[model samples]
Target: MNDHITTPITPDLLRGALELERTEHGLAPHRLPVRARAQGDGQLAMAEAQPSGVRVVFRTRAGVVELDTLRTRVGYRGMPLRPDGVYDLLVDGELVAQASTTGGKVLLLDMATGTAETRPGPVGTVRFDGLADRVKDVEIWLPHTEITELVALRTDAPVEAVPAGERRVWLHHGSSISHGSNAASPSTTWAALAAARGGVDLVNLGFGGSAMLDPFTARAMRDTPADLISVKIGINLVNADVMRLRAFGPAVHGFLDTIRDGHPTTPLLVVSPILCPIHEDTPGPGAVDMEDGSMRFRATGDPAERAAGKLTLTVIRTELARIVAQRSVDDPNLTYLDGLDLYGDADHADLPLPDRLHPDAATHRRIAERFAEAVFSPEGAFAPQPVTA
Candidate 1:
């Protein structure tokens, strides 16, 4: 019985050892070549690799300027204005692009088109044109008096890979409210807040004025990876009147069915629209003036159309809950959440939506607090249930 055995080293054991070593001594460093630059008259200029391709540059002067390239628009709230100034973009420290403005507002840039425009106004597209394939390195320069913040910068880098572990991803889709509308900061958006509270990673697909149950958006949600998901629908549909009741139900089912293709057993929650009296039981599209007490109601359809239960917010909320209820019998992991539960009649009375449509910063914080308690807490509603026979 004098036999000897040898243990084979497995990949997992090797990886564990490597990780332990890294944690103890830190990562090995690589030497970077250094370069010298010309210095003159108390000024020092350094030479670094010029970043290739078109990139946005942001600087400050007297007033404030913000650049947002994302789907959502930027808001300056209100800031003091300075004299006329030219905001310029330089390539290799040479002037190549510019936006002329009177200062004190949000500015938008479209690097793809090399165009710049002001916002809380018209939407514009920017194209880089003939320099698309040949351009590298970009810089932004503002006059010596304005203050600025770079909200977003376009990038072409490949997305980083997910870390190895039992990952849980939360996918949320909604309208402008979820798109950080009127929120004080990007990190303060309700979706971002909820994600932080719930301790889960998120892929926010909120699109302002673009969550109208489009087939493409549905397909995108269907294909995206998720461990848990929720869709805050209805308000945008009601405001837009994109479809009638007859079509709305089927669209909702289709949307859910598409998502189920990828996340069959994942926990899914369907939410209704929060209370907005303007569209509660009203029909068609309308706009209200916040400055004055003026209302513009469109006669897109007759009163009977509303009576027949078209795309009213109330009707959609009721039907969405019903659909999810019925579906839950077969798919136990599915659930329904009344959006008003986050900011019900009581909360609304205190923190009313500023524009009579979207919630302001204070209201957003309130909703995030309630949502964390209700859905994200350990003993909250979304907690996993015990398996049954």
Candidate 2:
């Protein structure tokens, strides 16, 4: 007789998502809650649904596990089809296996016209067998760059949700770089790697082109329960050319103020953008360089615009340092980290950004190492505080 058990995907078995949307095929994890999604654009929609740090967590003695999923893959019309998203399986906190689905829905975009088309496909199954039979922790990390709908999970033995034992929860918000851009897999993203090193549960809200200090996003961050919080700012603002320097400061202030409304004493760190040579002194309205039929980015805004309060990486960094310094006077838990400290000129020279924008896989690992050492170490900003009488 067959003894396999099939389990339905539920919130109890999932981590990192603020909300889950029920879909025809299965449940879709979302980094942002419904209210925040309602206020966002298409970019935010795609990014949030990618499930950067989201994963399925459970404990079981089964050696055989099967997961059914429907993945939504993104593609560009002229560019070669992107590779299928990767799903990583970790047993007892160690990466055990990696797999990719064969076919699923595909969303093709026309970059020049800003139009997109979606083609339907069927669900795919990812199976992992030959794991040790002893009871162990299991984490099935979803694809960080694809929209995944969880269908069902099958195991040779019963599975139970893992309890949130002693791990501190880390809530991070930023741009695409933090959204696992160019990272090898879900567990390899800089934020994920850093969270692993810190021994914290991660919640990543790194929208691709939509980290524009949206009020609703700040409110979402305010309402979320977290032991540690961080916001990586500057890049998206500059690339999108959404605001001037005059507006950027107040927007950042308001974002932090909103988060403080809920967790006034939580260790909150604000990080500026990492080094981007093209946008260092040049203002953005960054443009795609498609003349050679390859993806590259160049800043289009005039460097002279800085005199008119236009935002650049250098200017933003200075302003962020000033704001954090002034605010740290009243809020001791508030800390500022220069993005360059994570990925700076010297490091960039060694590992240049693949597209003059996002970091490649190796750079992601480097950034994660720097972040873990600087922010997760005992002396770091988010380090555990000693209790006093």
Model 2, 279-329: lDDT tens per residue?
999998999887565689999999999999999999999999999999999
Error of 1 at 236 (Å): 0.9
The candidate 1 region of ten consecutive residues with least summed lDDT is: 42-51
lDDT, candidate 1, 91-128, per-residue tens: 43455555543323445443345454565432222222
- Give candidate 1 regions above 4 Å deviation: 1-167, 288-304, 379-381, 384-389
Candidate models: Cα lDDT each: 0.53, 0.93
> Which candidate has the top score in TM-score?
2
